[model samples]
Target: MPVSEKTADRLAQHITGGFAHPVFDAQAIFRAVMDAMARPGTVQPVKLLAQPPQPLSPVAAAIALTLCDHDTPLWLDPALRQTQAVASWLGFHTGAPLAGTPADAHFALVGDPAALIALENFAQGTQEYPDRSTTLILQVVSLSSGENLLLEGPGIERTALTAPSPLPRHFVEQWKQNRARFPRGVDLILAAPEGIACLPRTTRIRLSEG
Candidate 1:
């Protein structure tokens, strides 16, 4: 269903209206997300009102609310395709376009990382405007282990938590290739039901090669 003006107005009211805490508190969440993205391999927290639909956890919705807008083109994975609630909420709140392919998307919501198509399938930016590439919102298993991987570069004060997931071995390699394109590679936000983390293209990830 299309987002009616009435729904948009209500959502705007809810967001702009007063909160128990300072209004900037919500704005602060946006800053936190930006900071996290600027430096990948790091975790950040944000408050959420209600749980978002499948594939898109509450944290993802919070991120979407903070960053997406009519200007952002969103690509939803199969898990989120039929989720009218999210589609309606996004349409009502941000008026984001539901894109048909990764290459055409500004941001993508992926539920099944294993099922996601090749990374090359998405925009890799260009020589003049590498920042034009896409950003991915990936729903992962967890962010607790504190062991089992290696993350380095850009954001690291000096290497942070051991990556919590057994990311596909090929992803790191593909990212290396993507980075050669410089500024053209995709940025990423890994989210779980409990928390969220960043993996901007600038971050260099090395899986434990054993």
Candidate 2:
């Protein structure tokens, strides 16, 4: 049976009013995610209402709510199996298409950052429109603070602070290669239960050889 238009409108209104923050909670979430993406390996916090899947953290759910819409396609790692509750919530709230493959996704989620799949498996954007790439939302163990690594690039004045713990070797290497492509690389958002951070495509990241 076809769902009633009134029911649909009510559902839309409910989703729009989901955020507790005053006016445009999605906008605030976008700012938070952007800040984190511009500074790779940094941690930031977010507020989420739904109880995410076992491995999917609150920070991840917040990202889904803030950034995703009907236009975005989401790909979930195998570790995050279909949790009916979470799926229904996402379907109603964001209406983002659930992607079946990494390359077909605009936002690919890594429920367990430590067990993230090979970076090569995902899309790397095209030569013409490099910015047409994916954004990976990773859920990390804990936000590790105190580090010597200096972050410098867009959204960064001279330098910014980053955690000491290095990302997986493969992830780092793939990112370096992606950077060389310029404009044609994936963005990243590392989220912890406490905070969230963004590493946009334009950001330049280097390991402290010290």
Candidate 3:
């Protein structure tokens, strides 16, 4: 059984919808993810959608399917951690192992952004191997309805503003510290119904004065 067919078979077993066409769906999601990551702070549409269990948004689910694999350890937040169905669905589809702690995850999915674990708690990688850091996918209320954030960095020629709601408390403060880590910090992917946006470590963020 090929991975795509095998995935379809498993999708039939679960109530949640995995990609109906795994290959094409994953490719579209991958390209969307790459675009978002490359742009940093820009909202990008995820062309593919997946109906993951409660607390796991479609965009986030599509991301997990496209990016996670057997080699990437996944961490779920308390809200998602307690949801057994979420674990089973992601485990079966992505073949990613559950990480024992936030620090251990290569990719951490945060279903509840309001009470997210401290950014400092996750693996920050080392100056020698920055890619070891965790990449967080967070579900938020809206992509443009929260606190206005001004971002400037490699991706934006001048500056960009975003306002994803229900972010963890002290996010700007925490982000300043995270930014100070330079090449060793974790990157963030914010998901909402409208789509997804990113905050690569190379990007600088602050509460927009505007």
TM-score of each: 0.79, 0.77, 0.92
lDDT of each: 0.69, 0.68, 0.88
Local accuracy of candidate 2 as per-residue lDDT tens digits, 1-210: 998998886555445434566247777777877766655655556666435445566667777888888998888876674554455566677788888788888888776555667666677789897766888887766556424445678777677666633354455566677678776777777776667877776776665565
Q: Write the per-residue lDDT of candidate 1 for residues 13-121, one digit (tens) a residue.
A: 4344222343465586677777777666667766664345444566666667666779989988777777666676666556789887889888887766757777788
- lDDT at position 58, candidate 2: 64
Better of 1 and 2 by lDDT: 1
Full ranking by TM-score: 3, 1, 2
lDDT per residue, candidate 3, 1-210, as tens digits?
467986776565455589999999999888777788889778887654798877788888999998999999999999898977789889989999999999999999998889997999999999999999999999887988898999998989899999998898899999999989988999998888888888899888899988
**Pairs of residues clashing in candidate 2:** 36-197, 36-198, 37-198, 37-199, 37-200, 38-198, 44-195, 44-196, 45-195, 45-196
Cα RMSD for predicted model 2: 5.5
Better of 1 and 3 by lDDT: 3
Candidate 2 TM-score versus the reference: 0.77
Count of clashes, each model: 0, 10, 0
> Which runs in model 3 stand beyond 4 Å of their true positions?
1-16
